[model samples]
Target: MKKFSFLAAPLLLISSLAGAQEGVPSPAPTPAPASQKEEAQTQLVVLETAMGNITLALETERAPVTAANFLRYADEDRFDGTVFYRAMSVDWGEQPNGLLQGGTQNDPKRILDPIAHEPTSETGLSHTKGAISMARMEPGTATGDFSIMLGDQTGLDANPDGETEDVRAGYAVFGHVVDGMDVVRAIFASPTDPYKGEGWMKGQMLADPVEIIDVRRIDSPEGDEAEPAPKETNSAEAP
Candidate 1:
């Protein structure tokens, strides 16, 4: 087990914001009526894993291009049969907690062209627990890979004073895991060490990697629509 610290700065800011709002209690703001535009801007994806199904709600309003890119991969069934090959709990000096990384890699060709990054400042989404964000070697190098933060990650978010240099930046956070967090926790608890050079564990590797088995869009009707039409019900008795 490792130790991780709270992201002090951002947490502090959030606390201050909370206090300020509390000090001057404003009238309860009426909920804005839902619109078609809102529905059109968001997408729900389900990642069927060996552990269980993990459902994500992608925020397209805050990250249109990034969200679209991720959904495109899902829609194409590119992530099916992939694995979550890397898990790292960074020792940030407190209770150790971290993220779970996974993506489509069982078929190399499924990997698509790289997409541009959308930082938290741009998307207005924090790197909180269950948030699904891109994984990259460096800024602006994200591709088919993505991860979900299992805990708060203020260090990975934006800061004007270069405080986030060491932490990954410019990686788009387009969605959040709305269900199946327990599955994520199970994956995180899988056996891990230094990976031997071979197979799925090549390059950035994990010793005992968790196999994804398959990753598919669970809710969409497109797959069903593609199936042959069922025999129509007839008013007359079956022959």
Candidate 2:
């Protein structure tokens, strides 16, 4: 995902297509930060999908606010019917690198408010392979949408030297794929829509989106789940 540069205002509304291409706050050092994971109260979310089960460990200790935001959606059952619609393969080239994008659509009826910006510099998290992060057009636009790095992505991490007009802030990595990376691989290798999408995202949208059956918290007591809202189809409908 592209880190925004010119936009002065925080993108209050993160794009629902993928995670908002923005970043977060906290510190998740290398080697998985087991201590930080525990302190962050890192929790797991099991995603039962058409492909298979994919479990993620969120870094709540390092990125509390961002992790809580993601967990809330899972606990509320808001992700049940959503689809993993975007896959940015190495073949797609520079901008997105290797990754998969999914989450809520820009449906005003169901989307929550955008959270504050959390730069990776602030979080001390890097966009390493298997790391999960939010997406946004501008800082603070991230809502329910997110991206998972398929490979090491130092490019998506905040610039250590300095933030420039070009580098901007990077994506907030709040979790990692603890299990079911094979499932993620299978989905990534799937085809993309030839006729849909535009610009850099053109031809990057999945031809037949992988449906997210359910997202639920595995580490703590969850709240009453609401039935999933219907999936959005027109935006990606085949001609």
Tens digit per residue, CA lDDT, model 1, 1-239: 01112233323111110111111111212232455225435566777777777888888787887887676666565566667876656555343467777775423466666677676656666667788877654456455677778776655554434433424243467888878888888888777765442432333345666665544444442321222223333232211
lDDT for each residue of candidate 2 in 31-99, tens digit (9 for 90 to 100): 434553345557777888899988888887788889987876776666778888878666333433477
Off by over 4 Å in 1: 1-41, 91-96, 105-108, 163-169, 195-206, 218-239
What is the number of backbone collisions in each predicted candidate, taken in the order shown? 1, 14
The models' CA-based lDDT, in order, is 0.57, 0.66
Prediction 1 global C-alpha lDDT: 0.57
Question: Which candidate number maximizes TM-score?
Answer: 2
For residue 48, model 2's alpha carbon misses the true position, in angstroms, by 1.2
Q: How many backbone clashes does candidate 2 have?
A: 14
Clashing pairs in 1: 81-214
